[model samples]
Target: MLGGLHFWFEIRIFMHFIKKRRNKPLYKKFLPLRKNVQNRNKLLWFRKKKWQKFQRAFSRLKKKKLHDPKSYFLSTFKNFFSRKFKYNLQNKQRLSLFYGGFRKKYLKRVVKSTLKEFKSLNKHVTVLFIEKLETRLDTALYRTHFSYSFKNARQLISHKKVYVNNKVVQHNSYLLKKGDVITLDKDVFNFVILNILDSEMWPIPPKHFYVNYKTLQILVIEDIHYTNCLMYYPFWIDFNSFLKFYER
Candidate 1:
């Protein structure tokens, strides 16, 4: 009788599961589920790519600050708190408070004082401070096609495929002035500039700039030492040494 009762309970549970599964459509129960998994995996990949991009951009900003400590720190703090206060409030009332027409008046006073100090430094200091940063790696990544990650930009440069103004530059720290030109290796040629030109779902390109498909050229930097070395020893050296070694 005990064994019979157990068998009946098992049958009941199996029926319940069948009922539950039956409520879902056949397509969802089978094929759609696989497609859902595939979509999820694709999303995960894009998220990872975005995260790596953010990390690289942040690191590049940090390096710029280190290069010019006083200006960088002052600008950073000013931007940080200023943006924080701006976002902290809302609408016209928020704007009034930020601009000193509101009760606190403290925010307006701070802003004015900061501006005054900034102006006292130089007549064009404010303009310079607000100007967009033009880091070498950023220029390369923006102009020529290179690595997807900022950290990867430095690595790509080390590979000796990145050129700035007709010179093969391998330093991410190299700051760029206006009118700089960047080129990529033939291997990464398509990677640097391939854009989606379709009406399909995945329409967004990996980066901000548009790719000129017709003008795109595949030209690898041939007879390169680092490329050969890396091909042979993928995991043999540290990143810094590897950069220096290939720099030769």
Candidate 2:
């Protein structure tokens, strides 16, 4: 009787596990279609978790001191594994299609247009790549420890908490240009410098405007972001020309 009761109890626990998992719609419905959608979902989830852990590890390292080589080595290994994991997870074609259709729509459009324009103007323009502009905004807010995550930055801006050149800017992803003074809600100004030291984290904004602080010059005041700004650069008049013009 005890053996029979034990078997019954095991069966009941198994059923409870099934019931709990069935509450999640994806797992419930995705049992049979193991070919395309299920695999794609798995890849997406793996990439997301990997990226989150990578970000957390990087954040912790940035805050702590690295005196010993052993701790540094482990942290470096974690970073490498995180990047490799992301690369593996990102290699799926179906997942790419899903992301391209919805979440990465704007990014794809921007890249396609930029590449097309580059090819048209200079047929020699071989290397074309797309990077998220939001990454810069995120660095300004989080990695630099200026504020926090992108979500917090957006919240701060929408509440009229950020300013540019003495005017309130509610837009979070405001593409910064040279000579554009970025202030904080009319309170204090943080000098936005170009050619920043940390090139990996804070990439220099796509060069449209040129600034020479010594000469006190500003060139190509194109307030617009992300279009043909970086594509067309006339060889005759270099970035120095802008400085000379401003100097006079």
Candidate 3:
């Protein structure tokens, strides 16, 4: 009877777990994330639960350090299975995608063209690649603080809410050029301005662009190289690994 009761209780707990996770956003569903808050700019903190998720994970880690036999064994098991030791290539690919929503093929093209462009200039490959990546319209929007996250900027562009040079352009991968102008619908643009006006975020307005807060306009004054793309690029990314990924 005790064994049957224990099995019944376990089934009830499993059902509760399923119900609890039903409404969680897609982001919180990812597990075992050890990234710092600053490194996860793509996370939109729409709810307090987003922050609490990290807190809970950290609390779990703290419990593992208490030296209990079961805790030590569990921690050892996790460390044995965790792939952080082999994540160098994964980190490089993530860096390329984190700032912008471009895919592997697009990233390959960016790397290829950036290498060709560097033939005439004396610059590091990764730095030049970062400069080129920043030329994306969505990256500029996120850097300018017009959007909350890189994913948010891509959503706005894909929804046809962003305008380039007074024309509606839905492609998030559209590479920006010098003399190009960016605008958005008046209501949404004003709302964003108000949201960001009093905020102080990292990697302040890039030096390569001009933003007219009053007129809701963005002008690209300079091209790659002159831009401060490194400010937002994650420092942990292995540029050498990224180069190898693209070279292949």
Most accurate candidate by lDDT: 3
lDDT string, candidate 1, 1-248, tens digits: 99999999999999999997775422222121111211112222334553454333333333223223122111122576674433333222322221113243433443444356665655332222112112335433523334343445566678887766568787655655544445556676665554212112221222223334454422222221232222211111222321222222
- The TM-score measured for candidate 3 stands at 0.65
Name model 1 segments beyond 4 Å from true. Answer: 1-132, 142-146, 193-248
Tens-place lDDT per residue, model 2, 190-225, is 322221232233223334444443432223344334
- TM-score quality measure for candidate 1: 0.31
Error of 3 at 130 (Å): 1.1
**Top model number, TM-score:** 3
Q: What would the per-residue lDDT of candidate 3 be over residues 66-153, giving only the tens digit for each residue?
A: 2221221112234633644345434644464456435677778888888888898898787787777777888888878888778888
Instruction: Count residue pairs with overlapping backbones in model 1.
Output: 1
Q: Arrange candidates by TM-score, descending.
A: 3, 2, 1
Query: What clash pairs does model 3 have?
Result: none
Instruction: Tell me each candidate's RMSD, in Å, in order.
Output: 21.9, 16.3, 9.5
Compare candidates 2 and 3 on TM-score and give the better one. 3
Tell me how candidate 3 scores on lDDT.
0.66
